[model samples]
Target: MQTSTIKLLRALVCMMLMNSLNAVADKVVTDSPVTDLSQFAYPVQDAKEAFKREQYAFVGIQLHDTLETPGVTAREVEVWSTQPVEPLNTRWQSFANIEEDRTALLRLRQYANRYNLMTLKLLKEKRRSDTMRYRY
Candidate 1:
């Protein structure tokens, strides 16, 4: 009778742990914002043109799409700030002073510029490699 009670108690403890784990998983899924990239209008090619035109909002949207692409993380975006450090005195203060919308737009712009530059560098390297291959 005591052995049966011990088995039942172990089963109950296992059930409770399973339930707690499921609850935590559900919270994580619900907390993350679902972004539909298909709905966004601007493409990467248009991003540079949009920036040149000073259409910051469109540029921001393009950047957001780029940042959301696979292998990119929130930490990468967080590290890429638009503002220089010397002006703010502290990093947190720089981020804090801006309105949420403005801050988001700035972040997007910074990301877009970085993305464009990286793309250009890759293309140049690819071209150089192709030239070297053809010459040999």
Candidate 2:
């Protein structure tokens, strides 16, 4: 009789634990919000990494012919956590124009990739002109 009672008590305790675990699993969130995706960002690790990450916002800067790509300049831009920088695949497509070599991404090795001078190519300007013509 004593052994049977102990077994029953153990089973009851396990059942109660399972119920509590199920409740916790149901309440946990699995997705980040649309506008506040920073929740999923990796934490800013070091000062050097932070500075490098911050430079990503200036990836396509130009000054010679007022042709600055103005990255991170125009509003309605997407930005997650600055401190914890992340990767991206940005492009500008229109009815008649589609950017081909466009890249505004933050790489793991920030300095090595930031100044690749990709925007120096004439492809983007050509695409923009076509887009303007289509727009008008």
Candidate 3:
């Protein structure tokens, strides 16, 4: 009876771990940062052109004088402050340029890595517990 109860508990734990990992994985896979064209229109358009051409270095160059125009930065900030807080993929905020592309991609990779690390940690704990259980 005790053995059955232990097995059931272990199964429950495994199920819960898998469910949590699945949620993380799902979030990582579907994560995409969206741009608000209203505020970031010109910058995004310029960045997209450079990005598509594979001239990443020219991204900043293209947006060099973007903020030189008065009220542009303030307008962007005002619009951004009103938007919902995003969990990830919001790169075009403070700095507006092509480098934000790299930042966004890195954020996605970070999420994937975090999920992998969590899974590994859980697996290591399970293995340690199983080995200790047998020794007893």
The best candidate in terms of TM-score: 1
Model 1: residues with Cα > 4 Å off, grouped in runs: 33-136
For model 1, how does the per-residue alpha-carbon lDDT over 76-109 read when each residue is reduced to its tens digit?
Answer: 3334323211111122323332233343444444
Give the TM-score comparing model 1 with the true structure, all chains together.
0.30
Scored against the true structure, residue 65 in model 1 reaches a CA lDDT of 20
- Model 1: lowest-lDDT 10 consecutive positions: 82-91
> CA shift at 61, candidate 1, in angstroms?
12
* Most accurate candidate by lDDT: 1
List, in order, the clash count of every candidate structure. 0, 0, 0
Cα lDDT of model 1 overall? 0.42
Better of 1 and 3 by TM-score: 1
Q: What's the CA RMSD of model 1 in angstroms?
A: 12.2
lDDT of each: 0.42, 0.34, 0.41
lDDT for 110 in candidate 3 is 44
* Model 2, residue 110: C-alpha shift (Å): 21
> Comparing 1 and 3 by lDDT, which wins?
1
Ranking by lDDT: 1, 3, 2
Q: Give candidate 2's error at residue 90 in angstroms.
A: 18
Please provide TM-scores, in order, for all candidate models, with all chains considered together: 0.30, 0.25, 0.28
Q: Give per-residue CA lDDT, model 2, range 21-123, as digits (tens).
A: 9876443322211113233243232323443443322233222233232223332123311332232221221111112212211221242233222222222
